[model samples]
Target: MTSFEELGLSAATLKAIAELGYEEPTPIQARTIRRMLDGADVIAQAQTGTGKTAAFALPIIERLDTRSHHPQALVLTPTRELAVQVAEAFQAYGKYHQIAILPVYGGQPIERQLRALSRGVQVVVGTPGRLLDHIRRGTLALDQVRTVVLDEADEMLDMGFIEDIEAILQETPSERQTALFSATMPQPIVDLARRYLRDPERIIVQTEQMTVPQIRQVYYEVGGRDKFEVLARVLDYESPSSAIIFCRTKSEVDALGQRLTARAFPAETLHGDMTQVQRDRVMARFRSGQAELLVATDVAARGLDVEHVSHVINYDIPLDPEIYVHRIGRTGRAGRSGTAITLVTPRERRLLKLIERSTGAPIQRLRVPTIADVIARRRESFKETLRETIAAGGLEPYVSIAEDLGEEYSPTDLAAAAFKLLLGEPPEDAEDLLAEQEPDTTEEEGGRRPRRRREQSFGPERGMTRLYLDVGRNDGVRPADIVGAIANEANIPGRAVGAIELFEHFSFVEVPSNLAERVVRALKRTTIRGRPIAPSLARPRRATGGARSGERR
Candidate 1:
């Protein structure tokens, strides 16, 4: 409930904040701003979308003496994308003051950074590697830096930037005020704070829960190759007003964005490789509703806060379960309901379970929509658009033309013609949108799959081959446990693992034929649900009701 004006910010800082349309300080901002202004070293823990940037930026900018500019404040981020974002925030908040901020990061010409450094900027925001490079070359002087901030400290440590961070910090003045912010305080981060930070005031923001209850979480089991086709169908069926699709890598973001664009989806890519200006323009388009979707990696979308986003799609299931929460948190803001959909390959279902446990929410299993469903949704959407237009009474001029056409042809025929023009050509075939469904196997008592009685060999399936495992339902084993062990131990894509049938004494799993041996070898030494599992090739049995090798069961 605190206002920025009450945070003891300078008049210039207050004016700039007001111009930026920020009326109140967020929890992190309210707690850390005043202490930072008081020149205290603070260690703050907060989530990604919280207003941590303004918390540190406002105080650092307010304390800057623009007249003696030589990097008075330095901010180190884990990625180049974050560096640019933080630098831009500083500039926007300090617009009324005569302050200059420079962002130095990789992918940009070092000479440009050197030129900016020679001009003596008041603030320098940079990534660890490039900042350390500047430090080693004696280009970026830290003698005048009175405040040093480490943003997303945990991410930097995860990326193996601890040594570079230490090297850069060692070059700074010993008396400089230090602030570290991270979502979680891991042991290494704690050790770093203990050794370097001088009696830091710890501010721990206790999160009620990792996920927003208003967000509807759903997952669709899909194969790796069929993912894009399924994603296209989902978008068409849902038709989100505005959405952000989270991908795992920058290359994936770019490729998927381009593909979506080719398919007539208004998508823009955001990642670390983009220039600062490109990133700004992409964000502008997204915020203005010109772009319907934003495809981005986790690092690029870290501090993004877009309230109008109605949907969030996780194109790639995150290896780290905690990241799932952050990806879905991009939506369902300001008490508005939103949808979060994740496409999980069969093997990745185990990862989804971990995320559900972390977020304390049950994610519903969603069936993939067929091509007919997309077409039906489109028709309904078009009808609604026509109804709204008719209600608005904007057809007065068009009525005469319609009447003339009606004289030559029946009204129904003319209307049908118009509909075709408006809706374009509907795809005739629905096979592309329809995902292949696995056959339902009957379960015995206590919900266990009935075991096959006869000795049979593993069945063959299209793009899959069945393997036999020595453990089954009686061994406290489930499909996900088996899939997780194979996927993790073999270092293979979860999508490569297919249908799994758990019986009382043993189980059968379908995997890509090329990877069957690898999976078997990996599972031999792996444990599922604490029980050691040894997988081997199973011969096809000529049992009376045995599932065919090529078909999913």
Candidate 2:
């Protein structure tokens, strides 16, 4: 029931919090802010997504002296992403005050940090290594720092940055207020706190039950390569208004973002490699609903507090059980129902089991949505739109057109044709749908049958056209490689790709005639075996004696 007003925050701080739509203080914020403002060293045990950033940031901003140009507060985070996030939070909370904040971290040019430091920032949020580097380079002075916060202390210890942390702290004023926040009180963290903090106020925020009753947790078992296709199907079936898809690595986030965009999903990516401006733009797009999906790594998503996310998808299952909980907790907020989905590959099932055991919440298993399911969902959505449109009474023009069309066809036939047009043409072959289906058995169990071959002399199979690429066996290209490239780049079903023929210096692939041009365009934007490829429609050739040795169906 505690509000920011009752917490004794200044009007400016309260205004910023109100603008940010925070009506009440979270338990951690309520307990820690006052202690921090009173210049007390505090050690708070809290997890991510519990408003911990605001707990420290609000006090830091309120207590800062705008007249001083030197850094008064130093926040050390475990990762560059967290540093940026924390720095941004400080900026947001301190917007009304004329305080300069700089986030110094690795992966960014040190020259930028040097320039900012030279300009005299009042607050510096940085990773331990980068902060230590600045200290060693004589570009940063923490002698006058009034407050120092070690954020995610356990994470820093786990990442083996304890020495860097110790070295950085030694450069700071011994009289400075020090606060250490960690999710768990590991012995090392306890020892570090005892070594530095002087009778710090220990505050623990008890997290909600791990069952996350408001969240409907489920997972799909899928192959690593087919994850994208399965995700597309799931997105169509779920039709989530907003979603965050978590990947394990920056590369995975980038790749998945591109794939989702290529498939016509409005998606943005957040990762550690992105610059601050780029990260800001991405977050802007996502928060404004211009982008429906945000593909991100765990580190980059730290301190993200969007409340409207309808779903949280683990594109790659987290290796740690606590991380799994943190990822899904982004959704199902404020007592609102949400869905949490995870995609588990065969080898990752053991890790998934560990998460279930750790959280004491059983994630229901789901079959990867089928093409039929996607189509059915689309039809239902279309019908809803139709009903709403009819209820709105704006169908006169369309009704006139339908009447004219009725002269040529029955009403039911006309409706069917219109629905077909809305849904687009069905896949030419049922194989296209089957390709996305979850395998009933593992490959080791011989779930797959040998592909049937059509002689190269006969050219591509019916309704298929052949395309040529400039690289082949010489480029170490394999059939699977070709299929993966075309299917992923073009956002087409794998079965839509026909036979692939690998010659010494070139290769030929068959795709649906309808999709030939699109495949060519997509291939132009992709590379194979680290070599760029120029794909074009293949010219007719004389009948060959038989299938070539390297040909694969």
Candidate 3:
């Protein structure tokens, strides 16, 4: 809870921090900034969205010799995207000071970088490969560099840039201060730190695991194709006063934002590709309530400080558990209750569990809001508006028209007609919302069950129903596949799938009776290892109360 000023930052840096609306330094920033300011070689383990960028950037910028046009500090990141992000952070924090920061990365014109290098920047943020390219060309000078930062060191190792990092470190002054920040310290990262850093102070920030308890975390297990529709359904059901939908990529942000706008959701998108002016405008609209929903990628959504955000929807789960924590942290701020909803695929169940363990909180499973649910919510909203209008007594002008209409028709009839008009066509049938699954039929085919055999029936267990799936052991199916498919498709928890009895060519899996139809419909449109499946209600067999052992192949 330390402020930047309290961390002994310069007045100019503190001003820039205030402008950015950051009042208190995050735990990582508080701990890392002081250590860096003291000129200590530090290795910090902190996740993205923990203010780690500012943690390193602020201290580096603070110590920059602005008079010298040479690069005083260098930051090595894992990707071009991260390089740009770090550079932007440095620029923002150093706006008042006469400091120049440049981001050099691949996919961008080398000439541009060369020109910037010639003009001389105080700091350079770049990826290893691109930085190494600059080093080879003698375009980027390292002799004057006094401090070096390896941001996301583990990620760099994962990308096979450890050797490049070593070469870069070797090129810098031996007396230069080094700081390495990573979410996890694998053995390779530890070894790199030991070799490069001298008597480094290890600082581990564990703030991400403590997400606000006021936030109601929930997730909808769903498929890729159905994600957007489910998002719309949840939005409709919740009717959040203000919401932010987090997507994983720029394309996803733009696509989802466009679709939401097309559906009249009052949304705007923010991504790294957007120009600064465009980003400002989008954020302005979002903060001013001109837009209700802001759809953005994680990088774009960073540093978002809005108090009225009532909901955060993970249109796509983040790559890391800590990023999930950061995304949800956007809401439930300013002592207000907020809802954080994630759309998790079945294959991603283990990841969700990891997030739960990391945050020390369980995310509840949420069913996709049905058509009926959406309709009821809309109706309630309209009714509330009507009641408020009546309470405000603003209908004095409309009373005359109402009286005239009432004279022509009974008051109840007129009110009913008005309500029908407000409701608007009753949200087309739920079956129409998606492909229809065949309904359960009790009628016998050939005076017996269609797929009946001598197999003992487990029947329905309490509030659960048995479903017969066509693909089983013969099709290379496993219990996990069935659980994953059903949980992901029907947007239910895998644990909610009751039991499984695998047979040679078919299998019977038990799912909550309430979700049986949804599970059926979801499974119908998908396949397990390229083999399509048909799920139907298992017919009853002659009473046998003993345990019905599964017929595994």
> What's model 3's lDDT at 183?
88
TM-score (C-alpha) between model 2 and the true structure? 0.49
Candidate 1: tens digits of C-alpha lDDT, residues 11-75 = 88886665443557867889999999999999999876566888899999888887896888999
Estimate TM-scores for all models: 0.46, 0.49, 0.49
lDDT of each: 0.77, 0.79, 0.77
What is the lDDT, from 0 to 100, of the residue 376 in candidate 1?
Answer: 75
| Cα lDDT for residue 399, candidate 1 | 93
> With candidate 1 superimposed using the best TM-score fit, by how many Å does residue 154's alpha carbon deviate from the native?
2.2
lDDT against true structure, model 1:
0.77
Least accurate 10 contiguous residues by lDDT in model 1: 448-457
- 291 in model 2: Cα distance from truth in Å? 19
For candidate 2, give the lDDT of residue 437: 32
Candidate 1 ranges beyond 4 A from true positions: 209-553
Best by lDDT: 2
lDDT of 3 by residue, 159-256 (tens): 99999999999999999999999989999999998888999999987764555456899988765545665676687689888899987667778767
- Candidate 1 residue 230 Cα shift, in angstroms, is 23
Which residues of candidate 2, in runs, are more than 4 Å off? 210-553
* Residue 449 in model 2: lDDT: 30
